[model samples]
Target: MTDTTRPQDPDSRCGFVAIVGRPNVGKSTLMNHILGQKLSITSRKPQTTRHQVLGIKTIGPVQAVYVDTPGMHEEEPRAINRYMNKAATSALKGVDVVVFVLDQLAWTTADELVLEKLSSLKCPVILAINKVDKIEKRETLLPHLDMLSRKRDFAEMIPVSALRQTNLLPLEECVGRFLPQSVHFYPDDQITDRSERFMASEMVREKITRQLGAELPYSVAVEIEEFKHDGKTLHVSAVILVEREGQKKIIIGDKGDRLRSIGQDARIDMERMFDNKVMLRLWVKVKRGWADSERALKSLGMNDF
Candidate 1:
């Protein structure tokens, strides 16, 4: 939204590009790689990205405001899942270009759900075949790519390895071609639309997701209590909310070891991103089944926080 209201660069090329896909299709990874920074948190877990993370990449004459949306899929309409779905689908509207990212060879009903949503879009949609590095046989992708291409008349069809930094230039250039000529919306140095505090909360949540058991991630959310910098060192205090006390125990670990690891890992990332020493204090508090309650979700700052 910040990028949308900025002054236009009359002659420069700038446009909003929404990156949409099913879970674990590397939407966040692609955004981070393209921006050359980790603005969106990523993990092996599906639906790791809960918000619409915007990363702005201003390269010379082309400034691409990349909207990295949460994975689109069918859900039970739980409060949290509905929130994530809303974030993803809402991002698709009012964008100049749409990047429909898909796994290299794996297509599923979830991907079809995302495609169904794109049916009404008025912008040019680019089909990006992600995770191509996993495909050892390049020839196998030809038939699949052709099949995908026939599904819709995509503005461009590309195969890329988001994690390995492969074949992104052509993708960016091709996207830039669809963008209307306009003035730069953001400063050349600004890479993302989110604040440092927001990224910090996501980093903390990411560590918990990466280190915890498979079932724990869906039951967790991060709340940033305090984020401040006293010139030399940045101090951040955050709360890790879990759905149940047992889940809280898992996050805290034996003798609080798991909690310590989450804090340590998050601190390291905070230091790297903030370019300053970080003192991160994390507390685990049980807010039972908050993900399923719309009231709890609202209180947890799920909307525009």
Candidate 2:
């Protein structure tokens, strides 16, 4: 005879879930879709996510802390690349569930690297093949799904279009089932684990990603030196850090046109995010070879390495 017992009460379910994948796999987009807010930045550029951002979701009696990590990649051996890889790997520790996001259209060598890592995790994993909308037919997905499933022991395999908000609820339900029953870790009203300054910096960097081409996006980082709020207005000052003078020239653009455009877009988003009027000041600074410097990487909240 088989003994079966019901799981714990719904009121006790709470835990952390990490989303891991290669760049442009729609991890951040899916996290925002689930939380129904833009807590993390997203862009078309590869490696758009540079840090591990936590977005919280509360439904009925469960609170799931979802971490969106930087895209895993094999790049030049540098401090930043090491930091990114470290940050992505660190999310697996103590996680209740792992959501391995993949681009259904383009599953390349980098995706294979992420898949190899996911195969070794002991916890429950859900293979989320995102961007299904981009694919022409459903049958085309089978080979990739079969290939991945055979290579790993994922608890469930689900397809989703993070950009179109399709199949996300089903994916959430799958992840929810894996979380252990426990007391809520955060209040229901809270949506994210990052601070306003951190989010603002990310917003600025995202704007850079959208406005600038691919070559310059990954080399850029934004630092918020000051953020002050009065009743009616918020004042913000940020510095866009680049790795070299050529990148700085490109970021500032001809006669500051590019910088102004980036600042305008970022300011608009910040105002919407903060829900108040804002006075934003943006400056571009060149820090040659900073991406490879441990000291510089540590200063950017990437001290974990």
Candidate 3:
């Protein structure tokens, strides 16, 4: 734990800024682009981020602690869905600024739900229209920006593409202007608040989510059973949980080929993240209907907050 209360630079500006949006809206991608590091896991699947991951960035004397939250959605049927909603909404409180990321042209009821949540908050909201790279017509933005302007009074609005690294400097500068004058809460070099074990586990899950078919990724979860560091190499043992026996087979593949691919890809990602050698071991286990069980979700640290 970093000493947040220690004596900080007097002229430093530090505050919490949250990234919130509907599922698969590129909120995680935006944070990673701004920080210049991949702290949050990214996949095409909705609700891939089930927890709040913090990334700290220092530019000159300003430190923006960006909290990448789970996508706030209306699907509350399962225990995991409800937990993700709670985790996402909870990030709104005590935040100095809110960066509401929205799809370039896809606005649905889920986006309305997020807008409603921001409507009542006291903090300033910076509306980020993400994925502008997909916009083929350059002249269409004027009217779209006009329509969004009438929706709500935003502190600042910018069209940015997180994946292509477009207009991120203006977005970061807009966020920095609203931060309260205070001392830096974290050291300049700290990129994220999460530990290696958690990131290693998420990296494995990201590969699984991206590699396997649609339904199986939603039913799967990764748990780091053990993580140890020997000065030279980091050892990680992860268990991949599934809802049934059939899903387990799919992840393991024929002759365990799929599992080996996931392990190889995850090991490479971890090695790059840790800047050292990583030995990763994976096992697929069946935790029948675990996603639907509240006790099971809590046991795996999904609802740890």
Best-matching candidate per lDDT: 3
- The Cα RMSD in angstroms, rounded to one decimal, for candidate 2 relative to the true structure is 5.1
Candidates sorted by lDDT, best first: 3, 1, 2
Compose the digit string of candidate 3's lDDT tens values, residues 58-129.
887788999999999987888888989999999988999999999997669999999998888988999999
Q: Tens-digit lDDT track for model 1 on 214-247?
A: 8575879888889998989999999999888889
Candidate 2's residue-wise lDDT over 161-228, tens digit each?
99999999999999888888887777767888789999899989888898885657467888899999
Q: How much lDDT does each candidate structure score?
A: 0.89, 0.86, 0.90
Clashes of each: 5, 1, 0
Off by over 4 Å in 1: 1-11, 213-217
lDDT of 3 at 57: 90
CA shift of 256, model 3, Å: 0.3
Residue 144 displacement in candidate 2 (angstroms): 3.2
Q: Please report how far candidate 2 places residue 123 from its true position, in Å.
A: 1.1
lDDT of 2: 0.86
Model 1 whole-model lDDT (C-alpha atoms): 0.89
